[model samples]
Target: MKKFQVVVKCSLGIHARPAAQIAQACSNLRAAVTLETDHETAQGNNVLEILNLHAAKGATVTVTVDGPDEEEAAQKIQAVFEAMGPKEKKVPVLKVAFFGTKDYDRLY
Candidate 1:
């Protein structure tokens, strides 16, 4: 088994696009791959699992690979994490106050 730790550099963190790309890369490898952060763990080849980790920018995540091609898998998987650059800012959703029909609704 082989592994490496990396910090997320992308501002948006490990969102959909990078997660998909990382998953695809892991899928192409012969080794079984996995990733873990302080908050969560994910199967490296599974986009949904990776996204569920919510590894925010500057967060550290460990990449692990075990199998016939563990070394190469580690190298490539590490690259996927490093490839993501600074995050781009997106428009924020506007939230509004809601009025309730009953006095009890004010608790919200």
Candidate 2:
């Protein structure tokens, strides 16, 4: 399993759109993805489950990817979160830092 933690930079947190995007990122992957907050754990491919995480700004989220395509799946999901940048009018400030991984750096 591949595991990493990130802070939610989006002002509004993981709402419908972000959740949908996260779900979409995992839709075609052969690996299983999961996101976890302090109080809840959610399936990365489930919009409702992601929304249920209720991760607000600055909330730390742990992402886990396992199975056949973990590397590809992880990269895809990371891109989705990275795309939620300052340019995104709907949900600006969305970014993440992959904790403990040399390949990732903090966005903010």
lDDT of each: 0.88, 0.87
lDDT of 1 by residue, 38-99 (tens): 88889988999999999999999988889998878888877787789764679899999899
Question: Residue 24 in candidate 1 has what lDDT?
Answer: 93
lDDT of 2 by residue, 22-96 (tens): 999899998999999999999988999899999998899999999999899889988887776446347568787
> Deviation in angstroms for 20 in model 2?
0.2
Which candidate has the highest lDDT of all?
1
Error of 1 at 62 (Å): 0.9
Each candidate's TM vs. the true structure? 0.76, 0.78
Candidate 2 clash pair list = none
Clashing pairs in 1: 11-87
What stretches of model 1 exceed 4 Å from their correct place?
87-108
